[model samples]
Target: MSDTNENKLYGLVVEFGDSNALVKAAERVRDSGYTHTDAHAPFPVHGLTEALGIRRTILPWIVLGGGLTGCIGGFMLQYWVSVSAYPLNVGGRPLNSWPSFIPVAFECTILLAGLSAMIGMIALNGLPRPHHPVFNAPNFERASGNGFFLVVEADDPQFDLQSTRALLDDLGGAAVSEVYDD
Candidate 1:
């Protein structure tokens, strides 16, 4: 494909020789004020997240909210049924027994927490991404193996084909190539 206006530009990808080089390139790209960038490596590379300037996620708070909702809902349901709806008196026991409600409320807490964790992770990470534009890069398949790569997304305000390519080259990146949205 040609680099023409007809082609939707995804971004530019640069393959680094090693983790150190990848980290350096990422730091440079971040320092150059490129906000939309990603680093790919076969395995975890220490300090790469910091180099990319990524912040912490709020998934834990989401799960906590879900769990609290479930617990309250479950307890109220049981309360309404036992104390108000039916009010069954078993063996002279008090109708408003709080102890029995604990088990169901606890179970509800666990269930909703687990469900929220799964859903939150999917939503936060933008899952179900069957394909990405970077897959169009040459030799990108190596990214799952030995390849270490950094991509500067065209969405970034500072992203320019010529200058970004030159910057990647200056960072000692090899096989620096443009990735198209196709």
Candidate 2:
């Protein structure tokens, strides 16, 4: 490919008539050892993630870390205020009482975990992305409504425009189009 054409190249997009075709195409692409591929559908299609060979996300770990930090911080804050900062004696109760810290600790843990999950998901997804290169392809607007789509990025080592288009066509893609860079 010429440098100018290569620069204009974004990827190849394959359109499927339904969820079954989308899943089958994804599986074929995965089995062909194409890693840099994505599938989109109007609704959740069973087994699509596995078909695409998508791995587990680290968002859970992020949330767990956030929760742990919140739990520890909450307990320490209470301890500092009651025992060291103020040292108030309430009804002959000990200043460093452990039971009184449970409620605040629990709330802090939940709050931090939930926030971390939302933020982590958005960050991982590269959200606030008003546009993507795939949107340049014809009929891409149907992806969110009735169409199922599979995209193979140009950066994939196995990608060759002619061969990739042929492969998609062979895999029952009704319409295949070249995606362009934004």
lDDT string, candidate 1, 35-154, tens digits: 999999999999999999998789999999999988999999999999899999899888878898999999999999999999999989898898988889888998998999999999
- The best candidate in terms of lDDT: 1
Off by over 4 Å in 1: none
Output the worst ten-in-a-row residue range by lDDT, candidate 1: 1-10
What is the per-residue lDDT of model 2 for residues 1-182, given as tens digits with 9 covering 90 to 100?
A: 32455557888888888999889889999998999999878898999999999999999999999999899999999999999999998999999999999999999999999999999999999997988888887888999989999999999999998888888889887778877785
Give the range of the ten consecutive residues with the poorest summed lDDT in model 2. 1-10
TM per candidate:
0.91, 0.94
RMSD of each: 1.7, 2.2
Report residue 174 deviation for candidate 2 (angstroms): 2.0
